[model samples]
Target: MASDSSADVVIVGTGVVGCLVAERALDAGLSVLMLEAGPRVDRWRIVENYRNLPPSMRLFHWDAPYPPKPWAPHLETRVAKESEQYLQLEGPNARAYLQGYVRYAGGATWHWAGICWRLTPEDMRLKSLYGVGRDWPFGHDVLEPYYTAAEYAIGVCGPSDPALQWPPNAERSKPYPMGPIPFGPGETRLTEAAARIGMMNLPAPQARNSGVSYHGRPPCCGNNNCFPVCPIAAKYDAATALPKIEAKGGKILANAVVYRVETGEKNAVEAVHYFDPNKVSHRVTAKLFVIACNGIETPKLLLLSKDDRNSNGVANSSDQVGRNMMDQPKLFAEVELAEPLWTGVGPVQSSSILNTTQGEFRNRYAGAMFRMENFARSPLGSAAALKKGLVGKALDTEIRRLSACTARLTVEHEPLPLPINRLTLSSKTDWLGINKPNIYYDVSDYVRRSAKEYTVPRLQQLASELGATSFQLSPEFLNSDHIMGGCIMGSEAATAVVDADCRAHDHQNLFLPGGGAMPSGTASNSTLTMAALALKAADAITAQLKHG
Candidate 1:
């Protein structure tokens, strides 16, 4: 058995956020430990994990049978197979369309279509201006510096001109750590058509590498597969940062699944008790505990840690830990261009049409476009979802067969919170003895109506301007697996689980960092935001530790 370790700070998950937290916290001279539930991931050896799986299943397939295909749902299910079917948050969702998901050491970063967009000033002020959503106590201006820092650290590449008329939020401090990926021929045709119609379109920023090196990491050769694990280190994965933290005297215990966070009578967390791979129970004590277990796991962990001391959950004083489940509603529609456009070659998520002008779903402050390349309808993924989602084959054979030649663009829109969608404990347990994530989501009438009524027509118009044969939201679509806000941040306990600093409200020394604390997801993906927030939290912790 490995020797138990301790530290002044213990970060529960070694995902990107946790790593950034450790990096910043370590620089501030704090002794830290990162606890990971999976094994130490060697990028080269692990790239094989991406191989041989069906293209449809590649992104979701991790650790072999452990995840099944695509990815397993974190939701509850009395029967395992039935649970997998219900867990898809996308693609033919039995109900709400929030389908695709995957889990790995790097967390979901392993297979994301790399987009790093900042939330708009409007996104933060959801309540004041919109009067429908909650307001972010914090705003983009506050995190802009960190956003720049993370962009460089994670090796982002793009041509941004916040001043540019199209594809809003394109501006950044330095040229990307990696230079921008030029628009492919297929996207270029669509761009011209968009220009013809006065709709803005531009190359979207991507997290994949365009160069041979950045901060000692290799560049992306346009690996078609961003899912599974990047065989080459072209894309940034949190595992890349893990070793640096470990090298700095940080102890990382693997395959140790944490079950409960034991707290003192005063409500400060004392230790996290977990089960090892061998089923041995162990405990790690720390001055502070940080939870970076993604959105679903973070809340589930907090709620599951209940004992005699706290019944509702460790930090359930607010009773809002597992509420406000948010998923970005995606609108994937593109015109079949009159000419052949080689759309399948470059990295996924290549470009986006910037939307700065106010509209129904977006106001001046809402997020901007997060465009990309390979919204390619694979052989199976295409033929099935006719139009946007499929009911039959006539649409599939005609529209999907030519996917190899079509130009693709997607609008990654933010969705409001679904109160009922959450991570609750399941009545059943996996063979590993850990309870799987159980979810219950009810899509709003507003979302269904808006997507069908508004977003779809816009995408169709885009395709038409480009001389597209057709365009429509897929017959099947769902919420993105990029889950956020299960445990939101706010000042009032009635509304949040953690505060702006990502600290647990009920436990002074415990911090919950990651997408779980995000009040709202920006235009791009959450990895960039989570990383920046982790830095801020680490700074706060270091300041307090220094004061004492």
Candidate 2:
């Protein structure tokens, strides 16, 4: 029962990147097998877990994300254990990094907040444009086709605005698979103010489907809890396409947590070792190996697999498997609008004030675009925002009002990279016995300066224009939950983890297809980039298999 299973390609982890790569491999005529660390999620059975709370209580802290069912406990354990490894904050008052991703068959996408923002062309071309970070070997133009393929695969919905794309971002070939989310209360007020102030209120791009069938997937029921678990198939999770893979002679086995990649005589990956649900050891072998675990797990898995051949880690001969962590700073401020803002609606607000459109994110000096998170607030966020943004007695009174008419400004922006801020393996181990991932990230001088000199003033002005009674700015740099890099992509083996195509530089067959490939995605949701990157990797592997 613990014998090795063979396939043309053995993909580790069944998250977004793994699932898409498996699909591409299957379509390319390769025998693929997806090895997962969690069990399969059943739609009909899982629906019973949703109590469906009232909209007001939506964002308050619940029972620590404990699943209502048996499977929920399993997921909780995995996430909690992993969170400890990657969720450490560098300073006090820094937002607790939210690394609460699940390991179930769908991985974290099943419970992901359905926001989808593309890393602008400038994000990929930071070095060439801003003269800051290293230049990506492949620019947005190179990944354009793959972006289209991946968007189609996931059923994305949004309005296409090629003109909206900042330099260094890939241009859109087609419109969003579905229409954009309608404007909500906060957005309406913000939009009105932005127009008055000569700013554009750009529509937010999302992974949620507005039509009946987006790439053959169902539309959302507006359940509102797009994070943690989505009952209906309205959202585009990578596991959305698992059925087709199974039908195409592909097999996905779960609870097989891959801790390390085993190498053969010639340093070719011989097998992958994982623990079953029963905690029994099992090994699976393949002609080639693909590493698609998310940012943290991907690098941790690599460090754990290090042998005498690599003192650093597997595919880490370049000593860059876990470096260059570049997640954006979460900018926040809240304002008590003098007028009613009316925010009560289903996933109503996700657009932003297009400061970049008026040349805010660009000055031929330093920049990255960011939008206000109007509809993305949780109860905790609202309470905290009120307390911080509002002063003393006014804070208590404003928070208690809970009026639909209110305004809060939260922005996620690209941050500068400091080599010290990275993911390294520590001597500590989790309950699972794998070495814990050590995340050492502090806000760079670039971001701190930008927040003070650039972001804060604009936010204060925007709020004032929106007729705010008061406004407050955060003193500390905030981190959006988007985790990326540590295992970055580049052409040089000595500098990065994988090449432009996302294949491991040291290993011919190993590939990393997720945010880990992105050295600097600025302040955008990484899901779309993850999809686009996977498609690019899939194409390269197909060419290799067919030729050699």
Candidate 3:
């Protein structure tokens, strides 16, 4: 093994959370090193990859554009038959646990819809308020400042009117960085239709620019390709923040798959061992280390790094390194409306009916957020038309009809952390001969009960109210990609992997930020919360360094 260098801090993963932590640490005048397991990729390259995809792959373009590197294999949900290659899923809800995350330099943010929703105050104290799940160590009021900081860093565009804002009651220290992106015709119509049912459809706060540029990126032009790849750099991705980190004196080592973390006296992480694409191992040492490799990979890395001192795993003294897995179980309904709603004029997901996200019913069932999916349906319609054997004008007409009339409404339900739904090391190995991540997941009775009793029935009623001639709810739950809860945070070291500040209780110098430390999964995209937690952890790390 070669020992090249060391830094003040070493961070794994180059996702939004990792990049944010790097930027903050570099700003504090600390030399930082980031290790990304996958190869560095450009935005235009991803766009080109999407464009080059065959018609059959276009429907699943999110997974098509970003192919996994050999050294850093991510889950591929497109090929159902090959699901066991990277993630060996088990249990009743294992099918729904097939996550869609990329291991590239930018991580999963490259293809995220950019929805930036904050956790409500109630969302923080789930166990206290509703008698289910675990509460965050701190409340929303504590994380509000960090939430604001994260929003400004990512250049969020949200509604100026408090009514349209997410968790409209959230205490705001400042308004959104930019005004809301105007709703497209589909969203406007859906909003109006929802109003008729006494439900409110509010503009979604997104990480894309709205009007004037804030962070050198141009405003959104509404090409409606927020997924797969945004042709323009209007949407915020970790790749955008990465260059800023490098500019601020941070080094990023791509294709460095960190496999082992070494601990020294007092259980402080001394160094991490990583292998390059050619399988050349290198040891990189640092004063402080952070594992920001999302929910799944972070725990997998911890479990993989079994040392003589910590045989179970690094930071597994609590035996909670890879326990308490959670995600927002999602279901959608495909409906053919009586009139043309024209669903594809702006960003893919601009608005959602969010009132159902919280309520008194949570004690009995799970909470859910509902949204009208805004992805352009032309590709799906065209594929369906072709499969029906339509030709020429018939095909074109069918495609247009389906594109204009069809709409999909999705319901994402919050799932409490379940220890049974855990991530363990699989016997299957990847290209580097490291064990793959095996997850045993079950959504449990909370999600299943909510889907049957509340979400599905409400969706059926809404579809009927929208004048749907053919409406079919999906029978199986799907993964929302809002992965959370593995290295969960708590007050006690015996039950949690990390503390409130995201510091690993077992390893004083190690920090595990992002979704892995989240105690609960709210009914929203978790990137914003993950980023906020990263910023919070950065502050804690800075304090520790100063004191030491």
- On lDDT, the stronger of 1 and 2 is 2
Expressed as tens digits, the lDDT of each residue in 303-399 for candidate 3 is: 9998988998999988888889888988999999888878889999888888888899999999898889898888877878888999999999999
Of models 2 and 3, which has the larger lDDT?
A: 3
Whole-model lDDT, candidate 1?
0.66
- In angstroms, the error of model 1 at 206 is 2.3
User: Candidate 3: deviation at residue 175, Å?
Assistant: 0.5
Q: Per-residue lDDT tens digits of candidate 2, residues 306-393? A: 8887778899887777777766677677666666666544453356544442233443323434455444444543566575778777
Residue 143's lDDT in candidate 2: 72
Q: Please report, in order, the local distance difference test score of every candidate based on alpha carbons.
A: 0.66, 0.68, 0.89
What candidate 3 gets wrong by more than 4 Å, as runs, is 1-4, 391-394
444 Cα displacement, candidate 1 (Å):
1.6
TM-score of each: 0.86, 0.86, 0.98
The RMSD of every model to the true structure, in order and in angstroms, is: 5.2, 4.8, 1.8
